[model samples]
Target chain A: MKQRFLNDTNLLLVFSAAILLMPIWLSPLGAAYPDLLQKFAIYGIFAIGFNILFGLTGYLSFGHAAFLGVGSYAAVWSFKLFTMNVVPAVFFGVIFAGLLAFLIGYISLRRSGIYFSILTLAFAQMSYNLAYSVLTPITNGETGLQLTINDPRWIDSMYITVEEGLPSTNLFGLKMSGYPGFYFCAILLIVCFFISLRIFRSPFGLMLRGIKSNQNRMNYTGLNTKPYMLSAFVISGMFAGLAGSLLAVTDPLAGAERMQWTASGEVVLMTILGGVGTLIGPMLGAGLIKYFENIFSSFNKNLLHEVFSFLPDGVEDVVVQVVSLFVGGGWHLTLGLLFMIVVIFLPGGIVEGFQKFGGVFGYGKNKNSDSSPQNQAAE
Target chain B: MDSILIQILNGLDKGAAYALIALGLTLVFGTLGIVNFAHGAIFMLGAFCAVTFRKLLTLSVKVKDESVTMFAAYKDEPYLKIWFGDTGEAIIDYAVPLSILIAIPFMVLVGYAMERGLIRHFYKRAHADQILVTFGLAIVVQELIKASFGANPIPQAAPDIVAGSANVGLWFGLGESLVYPWWRLIYLCFSGVMIFAVFSFLQFTTYGMVVRAGMRDRETVGLLGINIQRRFTIVFAIAAVVAGTAGVMYTPILPPDYHMGMDFLVLSFVVVVVGGMGSLGGAVTAGFLLGIVQSFASMNEVKSIIPGIDQIIIYLVAVVILLTLPRGLMGRAGVMDD
Candidate 1:
C-alpha cells in the first residue's frame, strides 16, 4: 500500500479524487454549490490552458479571453442550429477557438515581447467592439444570446419530438446542469490535466521550454521555433474553447463581457497567482480565486459580526469594521494586492511557497523551478 | 466643407488628451526603461485633484430654517459662499484651474515615492514582471480613488468665461452652425503650448541632454557621475504632472471616474504602440492621428459606407499599421521590436 501510494501515478489519482470529492471537502469552505463548483472546474481548464502558452513559451498574450469568448459563441451557435447534445458544441467550440487562435497567433507571433502583447490586445479589442455593435446578429448584442421555446433545433428534433420548453444541453440524455453538470466538467478537467501532463513531459514541451529560455540559441541550432510556438498557441486556445463550451453547456448564454480585456487579465492573474508552469497550480489558483470571489464578495458587516462574536463587544465591532474593507465590494483590492505580492516576492507563486515550507524540514527535489525570465542587464 | 472643419475641431481636443497621456507614457518608457501602467491612474488622480478642489470649495454648513416648522428644516450653504461672499463664489467658479496648483506638487511627490520606493527595485527585472507590478499598482491606485470618490462620475464645469461655444464658422465666413466650445479650443491651444514647451525643454536644456543620453545608453551616463537616478525620478514626476494636467483640464469634457484612467490607459498604450514605442514624437503624432481617424470614422458619411466603423477603427488601424510597418509610425529599430 505504501509503495503504491508513493508511486508517480499516485499524484494523478490523488488529484482526481480531490476534484471528484469537492462536494465533501469544499463544503467546509462554503463553496460546494453547483454554480460555483462549475465555475471552479471551468476556470481551472481556462487557466491551465493559458499556462501552457504563457508558462512554456514566455509569450504573454494579453488577449486570450477573445478565444474563450469565441469558443462560447461557437458552442452556443452549434446548439442553436444543430442539437442540444454537448458533443457537437464542445467540438465546434474547440475547433473555432483553435482557428481564431491560429489567425491571431500568425500575426501576433510576428512580434515578440511587449509588441506582441499589444498586437494581441489590439486584435481582441477589435473582436470585442465588433461583437458589441456590428456583429449583433450573431452575438445578440449586449442582451446576449438566449434560447426561445419555439426555436428549431435541427438535429435534436429529427431524433425526438418537440418538447414544451426550451431544451437544456445533454450528453446522451444526461442533463448538463446542477451536480451532474459539475461532474461532466470535472471529468473533462481530469482529462485536460492528463493531456497537459503528457505535453509537459513531451519533447515538444522541452523545445518550448528551450524557446522560452533562449530562442536565439534554439534558432542558431537550425531549428524552426515559429511552428512549435504556433502549435502551443493553438492547443492552449482549444483548451480555452473547451472551458468556454462548458460555461455555455451549464448555462446557455454568451456575452461580449466574456471577451473583455479585464477578463483576459483575470486568467493571467489566475495562472500567475497559482504557480506558472506547475500543472496543478493554475487549477488551484482558479479555484482559490473563484472561491474568494463568491465567498468574500458575499461577506458584509453582519456576517463579520457573527464570525467575530467570540470577541468582546468593543473588539468585535473594531474587527468587523476593519475586516469588512477587505471583503465584499472591496475584494478586488485584496486580489490586486495579492497579485502584486505574488509577482514581487513569491514569483513561483503558491506552489513555490509550499515547496519552501516543505524544504524547511528537508523535502525532496523542487521540481517547479523558477520559470520567470531572469533580469540579465545590470545598471 | 464646414462639417469637415467641425470634425477636425472635435478631434483636436480628444487628440490633445491622448497626446498628453501618450507623451508621458513614452517618456517614462524611454527614460526609465519601465512600462508604467500606473501612468493612467496618475491621470485619473489629476482629474480627482480638480474634483477634490471642487469638493473642498463646496464644503457646506447646515443652517436651520426657523420659518419652516413642520419638522426641522435646514438649508445647506457652502462654507466658501458664507466665508467670503462674492470673492469666494468667484474662487469656487475657478476651482478647476486652481487645482493645477495642488496637482503639480502632489503628483511630483507621488511619482517620486513610486519610483524610489517600488519601481527602482524592478528595474533589473524582466519586462513582463515590470508590466505585472505596474499593473497591480494601477489597480490598487484605482481602487483607492474609487473608495474615496464613491465610484461615481463627478462632473466639473469649466470656468464661466470659457464654458460657452464660439462661432468658428463666422470666423471663416462659413455658417453659424459651425460653433465650437471655448474650453475645447483652449484645450487645443493649451496642449499645443504644452507640447511645444516639452519639446523645446528637451531640445535646449543640459539636463534634457543627459536624460536623452541616458535613454540611449544608461551605463555610460552613470559612469559620468551625473546622479542619473535623481533626474529619472524628476522625469517620472514630469510624466505624472503631464498626465495630471491633461486629466484636470479634461474633466469638463468627460466626467471624471475611477475607471476612466483604465479606459484611457489601454488606448494610450495603443497610441504609444501605434506611434512607435519609446518614441515621443511618434507617440504625439500617433495620438492625434488616431484621434482624428477615430473622429472621421464616426462621421455619418463614413458610417454609411462601413457600418460601425467608429467603434473598431482604432484597432483596425493598429492592425494594419503593425502588419505593414512592423516598427510602428516612428519606431527606431531594436526598441522592444523582438
Candidate 2:
C-alpha cells in the first residue's frame, strides 16, 4: 500500500512540476502569457473531468458545455449577489452546475448510446437558445452575463467597501489575474489531477471501466450500473463546473456561446487528441489545442511570406497561399484536417504515436502495441 | 381558428425539410449502420452545389464602357445571356430550380467518393470512432465551403413567379391574411415526391430488397453470395443525393450558410432518434410530428402560456418520447434498443 501510494505521489509530483514550470517551458513557444496560461489550466480541468465519464464509461456526451455555461452563470451571479471573493462564487458555481448535471444525467442516462447523446444535445441546445433569446433577463442575451456597478454585493458591503473602479475577482487581497491567476488555476488543476488519479485507481473507476467494456456482462454478474454511471456523469459535470467557474474567476464574463455544441465538441477533440482515458493526456491535449489555436490564428500573410522568403518569389507566393489556408480564418480547416488524420492514423492519439515512435527506436517496450487501437484508446 | 390553420401550414413546410433530411439519415443508419456526423455536411455540400451552379450560370464578362468616364469603365453581363440570349436569362432566373439537374449527379459522386475513400474503412470501427471521424470530416467540409465562399448567409431567390405568398387559407375558408409562401408549397411537394420515390425504391425493387436483407443481417446477406457492400454504398450515395436535393430546394426558404448544415444536423439527428435508429417510416412520421409540435409551441398563445417552449419543445418532445416509448414511434424491435 505504501509503495502504491508512493507511485501516485511520484506521478503527481512530476505533473505538478511540469505545470509549475509551464511559464518557463512555454516561453520559447510564446504561449507563456498569463491569460493564455490560465486558459490552458482551465480547459485542462474541463477535459480531465470530461474524461472521467467519456474515457472510463464509454458514454459519449454531447452537452457537457451546458454544465460549463451553467457554472459560469452561477459564478457570475455569485459575484452580483455576494462579493468579488472567488471562494463563494466558485462554490455556487459548482453547486448549480452539479445540480443541473444531476437532473440532466438522471434523465439522459435512462437511454444509452446515440440516443443518450442526442438527448443531452437537445437539452444543451434548449439551454443555449433560451440564454440567447427568452432568458435574456437572467443571462443578458448575446451581450453575455457581466457584472455592473449597481450590483448589490452584500458581502462587500459588510466587509471592505470598494470606492474605486470595478472590483476584480480575488482571494482576499491577491488578485485573480496575471501570474497569480495562472498559479491559482495551476494549483487547482494539480488537485483535480490528483483526484482523477485516485479515481482511476479506485474500485468505482474499475466498475465504470467494466461497464464500458461490457454492460450486459456486468449486469449478468449482478452489478447495477446505473448509479455508477450516473455518479461518473455528475462527478465529471462538477469538474466541468469547476473549470467554468475558474474561467469566471480569471476573466469574469460568461457568454451563451460557452454552452454551444461546438464548445462541447472542442473538449472531446482535446481529450481524443491528447489521449482519452490517460491520466496526463487530457491536460496535454488541452494545452496543445489551446497552443495551436493561439499560434495558428495569429499567423498572417506577412508572417507566411516572411517564413517562405528564402524560396524564389513565385514559389514563395504559392507556398504562402497554400499555407495561409491552414492558418488565420482557415485555422478550423487545419483543426479539422488534424482531427481526421489523428482519428485515422493515431487512434490512441499523441500518446500512442509517441509510444510507437519510442518502440521504433528500441527505447521502450510498447506493451499497448499488442492491443488493437480502439481498446488502446484512453487506456 | 385561422391562426391554428396557419401554424399547421407552417408546420408542414418545416416538416418537409426535416423529413427529407431525416429520411437520408435513416437510409445511412439502416444500410451502413454508421452514425454519420458528416451527413449534415453532405446536405450542406448539396446546397453549395446549387450555389456553385448558380455562380457558374451567372459567370460574367467585362466590357469596357467609354461613355461613363475618360477612364475605362467596365459593364458586366452574364455570359449565359450572351450565349443563349433570353433562354439563358430564364435559366439564370430559375437557377435554384435548374440546379437540381446538375446537383443530383454531382452529389452522388461526392457521396460515393466520401464512402469509398474515408467511410469504408470505418465500417467495423466503434461508433465513437465513426462519430469522431465523420464530425472531423464535417468541420473540414464546412471550413472548405467557408474558404471558397465567405461565412455570410448567401440568399438565393426562387423564380419571380413563385416568390410571393399564395392565399393558402382561402381553400380552408379562413381569412386571406393566413397566406403561405409558394416556394414552400413547392418544397413540400418536392419532399413528398422524394420520400415516395425512396420508399418505393426500397419497397418494390430487387436491388433494394437485397439491400434491406443486408441491413437486417450483413453476414447472412453476404452468405447468400450478394455483393451487399456495393449495394450499401449505392444506398449511401442515394441518401446523399436525397439530402442534397432537399438542401437545393431549401436554399430559397433559408439562405445557404456554412453553419446551416450543422444546425439542421443536430435537429435532424433528434428527428432520426425520435423516429428510431433504423426505422425509415419512424423517421418520416417523427419528423412531421415534432415539426408540428415545434410550430405549435411557437404560436403566441402557446408561448404566452409556457414561455420559451418554442425554443425547446422539439427537444422536450424528444426526451419525453425517448423516456416513454424508448423505441420511438415506429421503431423496429431490437434496433439500437440497448
- Candidate 1: stretches off by over 4 Å: A1-8, A310-318, A370-379, B64-73
lDDT of 1 by residue, A1-379 (tens): 2343434477778889999999999998889999999999999999999989888888888899999999999989989989999999999999999999999999888877787788899989988998999999999999987777766788988998887778899998999999999999999999998888888879999998888888888999999999999999999999999999899999988999999999898898898888888888899899989988999899988889999999999999999987877889878888888889998998777888888898999977676574543721110
- Point to the candidate with the largest DockQ: 2
RMSD of each: 2.5, 2.4
Which ten-residue region of model 1 chain A has the weakest summed lDDT?
A370-379
Q: After superposition, how far is residue A65 of candidate 1 from its true place, in Å?
A: 0.6
The lDDT values for all models are: 0.88, 0.89
Query: Candidate 1's error at B80, in angstroms?
Result: 1.0
List, residue by residue over A1-379, the lDDT tens digit for candidate 2. Answer: 2344336788899899999999999899899999899999999999999989888888889999999999999999999889999999889888998999999999999888877888889888888989998999989999999988888899897888677778899988899999999999999999999999988889999998888777889989998989998999999999999999999999899999999999999999998898877777789889989988998999999999989999999999999998988999899999999999998998887877887887888864553332235642221
Q: Rounded to one decimal, what is candidate 1's iRMSD?
A: 3.2
Candidate 2: residue B124 Cα off by (Å): 0.7
TM-score for each of the candidates: 0.96, 0.96
Deviation in Å, model 1, residue A67 alpha carbon:
0.8
Give the lowest summed-lDDT range of ten residues in model 1 chain B. B69-78
- DockQ, per model, reads 0.58, 0.60
